[model samples]
Target: MSKTLIVYGSTTGNTESVSDDIAKILEKNGHSVEIQDAADISVDGLADQFDTVLLGCSTWGEDEIELQDDFIPLFENLEQAALKGKKVAVFGCGDSSYEYFCGAVDVIEEKAGELGAVLLGESLKIDGDPEPEEVSAWTESIMTKM
Candidate 1:
């Protein structure tokens, strides 16, 4: 089974809740899963620990990466050499009314690619709140890839 890390940055717990649900689904499917607060995870040591790295964040301040004030620094310090060949996924919560729906997920996707990580599945975007069907589909897609 592939090991997956679900890291999330949530200001009001929305993204955290979604990340937890995704982790539960992954674990239920017999995959080893680690759920961490994005701020608490070490970008340096993450490369060797898991086969898949999933990131979740909510949009803040006009499509800018949320809670990125901290996570971005960690991500900036990350070298492409550290993440080469790793599989990755991104999921996030955002307001669809915003011009850039799921902008946070997009940021994670772009950065993950720059680090040479392969996307495990399509990025999932939840509007305001994540629906059960959406989460299930996203979880299933990632499991299928694994």
Candidate 2:
């Protein structure tokens, strides 16, 4: 079984809820899963010892893309996370009304790829409130990749 880590930054708890949902799905599939709040975790070597790393951060701002406040630090310091060759998946919640809907997920996905992380699946971007069924389906897709 793979050891997976899910780290998320949520303002209204939507992203955290999604993270928990993904963790449950992974656990049910016989993988060991650890979920962490981005505010409480350091980015240094964040992907170490994990077979898969899942990153979630809600998007803020109107005209521009702004990662959730708690995720800003982690995203800025992602280079130190040792993501090279690590399997990575990204998800996030945002408002489609915004110019950059779920933009945080895009940025994270790009960074993970730039850092040499192997993307496990297409990113999951939920507009407004997150739905459990959608998240579950995305997790299942990732499981197949694993």
Candidate 3:
């Protein structure tokens, strides 16, 4: 079984709800999974655990970083070269009418790429009210790759 980590930052709990669903599916598949809050995590603390990382967040105003207040500092503290070769994926919740749907996922994916982490699975861009089937499919696809 693959060891997986799901880190999420949600202001209104939408992203957290999604992460919970993903974690449940992964655990049901017999994979060891840990769900964490991005706000409380530190790069140093995550240095040596798990092989797969799933980041979830909501899109903030003006297409800016959703959980920038938390993730920004932690992300900046990491050594770019140190994160090379890591495997990661991103999923975000946003309102499609906001003009920047899933903008948080965009930022997460870009940063993960820059850190040299191999992108795994699709970058899930769930609408304001994401579809269960879609989220299930996303979870299934990631599990297959894992």
Backbone atom clashes (below 3 Å) for every candidate: 0, 0, 0
Best by lDDT: 2
Q: Indicate which candidate wins on TM-score.
A: 2
Q: Per-residue lDDT tens digits of candidate 2, residues 43-132?
A: 889989899999999999997899999999999999999899999999999999999999999999999999999999899999888888
State each model's CA lDDT, in order.
Answer: 0.78, 0.93, 0.77
Tens-place lDDT digits, model 1, residues 1-146 = 88888878887788889888998899888999988887787776676778888888787666454534445655566573256788888888888887877776887788788878888878998898779888988889888877
Query: Total backbone clashes of model 2?
Result: 0
Per-model TM values vs. the true structure = 0.89, 0.98, 0.88
Per-residue lDDT of candidate 3, residues 57-135 (tens digit): 8877764545435556555664532456767888988888777777778877887888778888679998877678889
Candidate 3: deviation at residue 43, Å?
A: 1.6
Candidate with more favorable, higher TM-score: 1 or 2? 2
Off by over 4 Å in 1: 63-70
**TM-score for predicted model 1 compared with the true structure:** 0.89
lDDT of 3: 0.77
- Evaluated against the true structure, the overall lDDT of model 1 is 0.78
